[model samples]
Target chain A: MLKTRIIPCLDVIKNKVVKGVNFKNIKVMGNAVEMARYYSLSGADELCMLDINASYQNRKTFIKTVEAIAKVINIPLTVGGGISVLDDITDLLNAGADKVSINSAAVKNPKLIRQASIKHGSQCIVVAIDGKRHENKMKVVVKGGREITKKELIVWAKEVQSLGAGEILMTSMDTDGVQNGFDSSMLKKVTSNVSIPVIASGGVGNLEHFYLGHLTKSTGLLAASVFHSGKYKIKSVKKYLKNKGVPVRL
Target chain B: MKKKVIGLIDGQSGNIGSINKAIKEIIKGRPYQLKIIKGEFDNSLFSKIILPGQGAYATLISNLKKLKIYKPLKKYLDNNRSYLGICVGMQILSDQGHEDKTTKGLGIIAGEIKKFKSKKLIIPHMGWNSIRLNKEDPIITNNLDNKDFYFVHSYIFQNIKKSNVLANTHYGKKFPSIIKKGNIYGVQFHPEKSHKYGLNLIKNYILKS
Candidate 1:
């Protein structure tokens, strides 16, 4: 049977993990690879490392970071941020990333998503939709949520699926890191609309938030700060969800 | 004991990094040499040939035949050597594939690769899923029974021979996850990305098989 994936996300700034783990009990030093291995051993089904570097030169450094993480751990790694053209997808996938997450650049030119899924298989291409709500409407946001595009949420998601993207990583800027919960209704709208797998990201503050995020029927649940702060381990979270009747791998 | 050589057939377009790293890590301090077969490779140099694929089945059909990797690979398989196929590599053993288009597979196993048809389940079947062993092989099924391996694909073998299927996984229906006939072994999961269980599977395939 297929189980809900518990993904631990990391913010990579030029090959180093920032806003990372500070364990109060365990004496663990957090590097990109160490923290990645930490999460994998802690029972994270997959790991997503977003290159938060605003600088252009950090592209090379991010690839190195991806290679480093891939060498140590043996789980799927989805690298996001700054993926514009076909070559960006090639470089990251060659550097040992199982999947590449394209956000803003895919919206600017939707053909890149098609070209990518055609050249590389759709299994490796993940179209990340960052959405934000305004006046009873949820619009697609890009450029790290700085710029909101004219594309609506569900329409763009259906478009990417038709364009050959295998998965959708829906992150809502409004609830991101806010400790409230995920945009469950918005995620439900997108997840039910698309036939592909939808991963619910963004706001997941408490343990129940993860369960609520999964209740949206998103196959994968991704969280960052909660796991990084050592407040909740992936194992404990999976246990919580398992007891709640969620089929999680223990 | 003579040193054993493990040939990783790289079609050049496929992702062979994690597999290469896994082979290297597994054979550390052991009397084994890892050979990556990209263009031309000698047929007799390897004891085991592994085709670790990640892309679509159509691309596998094109790139494998286009590159110099085909003739030697066919020779290796025809000779009945220990061959392990991962994901697309495993799917290519079918007679035909319908992923991108109507493409032909190696036909080592009698089946047609088709997309999953279920309104209730998600496409791509991406996650950690368990394997149900049909006929246990000491090397392949060793320590891997009922353990969830990472699977990320949209296609599966529809009419695979029941006698050849070593293990099967369930989504909305039962599908072959591990198929083997003689020495040709194929698994429809990413062992290189499946952490310890995956690494152990690889090590067993390399050192023991």
Candidate 2:
């Protein structure tokens, strides 16, 4: 049987990790490579680096950060944020990233997903969906959850699968930064509908929240604040899940 | 005497960062030099060869051809020199691969790469899964028994001979996780990314063999 993966999602800006409350009120943790090295050596099965820097100069810094982290870390690294075209994906993969995540670009032009998966295998293409609750339905939101779309979350998840996405990184904008827990019901809906692995992101406050995240049928549990702020250690989370019979690597 | 160098072929196919780092870490105090083979490689300079790959099968072979190592690689395999193939490098050792389209492989072994067909499981079998060793090979299964190795792939070599399989792991059905024919070795899992269990395997390959 496959073990559950614990991933720490680092919001990187100018080669530094930044954690925000409800996607705002940003605070810097430390250097990106140092933080990533700590998590990888601890118990993180994989690490996700998202470039939150909006400026062009900062994006170059993010790529260099990825290269530096890859040199020290011996695990799979997934790089996301501002990946609009195939060349962007190529640049990251060439820089030692195992996978490149596409969010708004995949929604804006579905062909990019097809082109990326075709050029580089689908195993390296992860489609990230940022969704928010709207009137009893999970609506797909882009632009870092600032804008909502007519496309529903479940529908877009299935569409990405058809367009050749290896995995889906689903984040609940409503629960993000609140640190209560994952949106289990929404996660269950998407995980049950799609065949690809689903990584549940956004909310995780305690060890029990990670347990709940795995219980919802997600292959991975990704959190930002709990991991960044040093409240919950990755080893404890893996040990907790192993005790709960969740099949985690301890 | 010159140092016994291990040739690592990087055909500009995909990322070989972790693999390169792992090899460097393993050969720190050893009696071997790690050489990254980019363009043309003189086959006789190295005692062992390793091909680590990612991405599509067509792109990998195309890059190998573009680098003009296709013929030399085929010669290396034919001579039964110590060789190891990781991930897509393993898949390309068969007769053909059915990814995106049917791409011709090196034909160093007797098999065809087929996609894993399981209505129960996902396409790309990604994550850490335990392997059941069928038989013991010193380089491939040294100090490894019923241990999990990291895997991330969609297709696997189908209908391989029983003697060629060193280990197999189950997704929906059992597929070859490690395969060996003569001096040639192929592993479906990434030993570099798989922590201790994987590092031990690579160390055994370099030090023991």
Best by DockQ: 1
Chain A TM-score values for every predicted structure, listed in order: 0.94, 0.98
Extract clashing residue pairs from model 2: none
Give the poorly placed runs of model 1, Cα more than 4 Å off. A20-30
Query: Over 4 Å off in model 2, which ranges?
Result: B140-142
Docking class of 1: medium
Clashes of 2: 0
lDDT by residue for model 2 (A114-196), tens: 99988877888999999989888889999878999999999999999999999999999888888799989889999999999
Candidates in order, TM-scores: namely: 0.95, 0.95
The i-RMS of every model, in angstroms, reads 1.2, 1.4
**Chain B TM-score list for all models:** 0.94, 0.96
Error of 1 at B182 (Å): 0.3
lDDT of each: 0.86, 0.88
DockQ metric for all predictions: 0.76, 0.70
> Which 10-residue window of candidate 1 chain A scores lowest in summed lDDT?
A20-29
